[model samples]
Target: REHEPLITVEVAVQLTDAKKFFKVPRTFRVMVCPGATVATFREVVGQDLAPSGRVMVPRGKEAMMALQDSEELPDKVTVTEFKGKRQVYVKFTMAQCYKVLSLLRGHLEKAESQKALHEAAIEVAEDEMEYRLRLSQFLMTEAYPVVCRHFGLGCDGVESLRVIPAGMYLVDQHLELLELQLEVETLMKNRGTVNFLMGKINELRHKFGLPPADYPPHLLNFVYSQSLLS
Candidate 1:
């Protein structure tokens, strides 16, 4: 059978463990006589690729068939038999295997840690929303009514007093109401002072036998208005 014609066959070195990380396989080609024993073919392939590994062939669609030492290479062996196939799976030495395992473990741990942090952030956001909701409810239902009663304002006044949209936080509205109260108090004080001064001026005009000074209608009305008092 030494006179048999040589056949070319494709051979790929399987990166099994490394492929899980790198995802690339290695392939090459070799010429062999059909009469050669599987062991001899494996030796020839191993010498060029991995010195220590088993040679295999495609069994079916998804299975690899390991070639036995005593078996002979099929007479019709062709490149298509091993093309894009995992022809030989090379096993890493013990040390290399351990290093790959360690890397895999670290990657898994990091993924778990990231997932845990994401879940924690979601929980914190939920809690904050709940607190804001509770605070807003208290301001609207309890605090707002009390503020309205204190200022002698009716429901319409409370509605009109909102300077911000209803969707916004009620705390800002409460602050705006307090500012309005302060402004009202200041206006009342200023009006009283103006009235007193005006009365004194009129009295002086009367003693001098002159007519009272005519102030602007808007100013007089503003100083004497009683809307806020009611």
Candidate 2:
């Protein structure tokens, strides 16, 4: 048995109705890795208890519900002891099972999207610092919310913006204007591009309910000069 594959275990899930009554007291067997998480078994069992499809059950009245009720599935599922056997056990109404399947599907899609975006962001970043910052921002702003939503956790979904001040985005704009002013440069007459970038910064701030960024003194002078020149 030394080189044998890891033995798979049978997880028993008992089917019940929303009322916690043993509508179908029989245990259904699902094969999975011994160390698999409860979520894994839930998915396996959910598929076996597929809604809107026929499963081979002896009793003719054992019709699976087309979907699960939202209130039926618990936030966390764990293996509990039953009749002195060390086996995983769960109970779900047909409606609850369907709901679980739908939720799992949506969660998988969101997780995949997060992973794709993270990889793409890393590739697109110009330097290591940019990649790290962008990755962290994506995780906090996008991935964290997706996870929180799936787990029914309270999330404001503004974690990244909360950590990064509104003025940070405008810092480069302020510096550029200051440099132009100190050099007495007048080659860049139109402030349209600067205004557009500022507009975007303000739009982001408004969307997230963040305070408006204040202009640095030198930058303010440049804006004043532009307005007079225009």
Candidate 3:
């Protein structure tokens, strides 16, 4: 209720999603209460403004009031472009109309979801394969040396990375990285933690024992040469 909302403003609405492509209303009106503030107008219908393809379910004070008892009235409706073309019964209240609007928030837009989902799916696959290879190599070449140096449990014939408890050891190594990436992605999605993103980079560098990213070029080159030659 906005504008001339005395007791309550009667309204009609349609909101739903199970249709082809994005939906939009065939036609709609711009009527608003004469003295309704911009805030009031927003309160009433600001959210229904999605373009073609997104659900444009009908919404209006008159429509909601008019179709209060129509048998053909939809419990929910999807919109198509050109609200004039989309046939929807009037909604009953801004609240009822907006309830269906809630469904729109998580609706995956095709391009974004596909790209993100594909990236995630492929990333997990590639990371898993790489982790398996590196971990297998680590057990044979590195862990035994480390274990021998530290615990002395590494004895004869312990040639490879000890296969500890099947997949458990491998999971421990890569899962931490995966968890960090997931946390970063979640924060980014909600437009949060620019500071944390920077902090994370610093933390990861230290955690991985990495040299400063901006280390002098000659020093880096010498280090690289030493690594290769030595």
Candidate 4:
């Protein structure tokens, strides 16, 4: 068995194979399961190490008949220990290579199916800020003019309104009115006129010993208005 030369066999494969070639030849490597020597392995039927260049693999589907085949199927194995004392190696025939690859193919398909199902089941929610930003984008991009169209103003200056006091302006004349209205509103609020009034009352009551009901802001007449009226 040791002196026997490995017989080279010619392999003939047809090329009508189109998409099948796209599926690259996948290798399913595994360490030879130790403690199962070729002798003990040969005991099983239909399992003869093939006469490939090296390495013997099963040629049997049956436990009894395969061992008989191995007696004639000289050993083609060349054992190599990987790295240090990690593992012993034994090669297999092309037929055995197919067996391992078949198992891998099945497992890979199942894994892909599971991954797809997991992805489908997931329901990622939109964040609050993301939704608000989308609403802002739609308003800035589309809503303003559409609303103006509803009013029949023939307005088309939505993008310009990125600043405040933005809507429904015919020209620069409206800007001063809008500014005054904003100032009036602000002065009327708690942070404006109300606050100023309260502060003044406090100053009068504490510094002058005058009550709030008796004190109001002292009026200062501007020269322009007074002179004009005169």
Candidate topping TM-score: 1
Q: What's the best-to-worst order under lDDT?
A: 1, 2, 3, 4
Model 1 residue 179 lDDT? 30
lDDT of 1 by residue, 1-230 (tens): 01233354556555555435576555654445456676756544443434345567777887777666788765322222232322322222223223322332343245553354334335445353443344344335534454334322233223422411121222122333223322332232234445655665566566768788676775577566752121
Predicted candidate 4 versus true structure: per-residue lDDT over 1-230, tens digit per residue: 11111131111122224675666332212222233343433222112223321233335562222223223332333211112111112233233333322332343245553343233223213233443344344334444344333323233444313321222122122323323333332221112333354444455455656554332322212111221111
TM-score of each: 0.28, 0.19, 0.16, 0.17
Tell me the spans in candidate 2 whose CA falls farther than 4 Å from its real position.
Answer: 1-126, 158-230
Where does candidate 3 have its weakest 10-residue lDDT segment? 163-172
RMSD of each: 37.5, 20.4, 22.5, 36.0
Please tell me which predicted candidate would have the highest lDDT against the true structure.
1
Residue range 83-177, candidate 3, lDDT tens digits = 23211112113332222122222222335543543454345453534434443443355333442332222232233232121212222233243
Candidate 3 lDDT score at position 136: 41
Off by over 4 Å in 4: 1-83, 111-230
> After superposition on all CA atoms, how large is the RMSD of candidate 2?
20.4
Better of 1 and 3 by TM-score: 1
lDDT, candidate 2, 152-196, per-residue tens: 333334532332222122233343333322222111222444455
Clashing pairs in 1: none
For model 1, the local distance difference test gives: 0.42
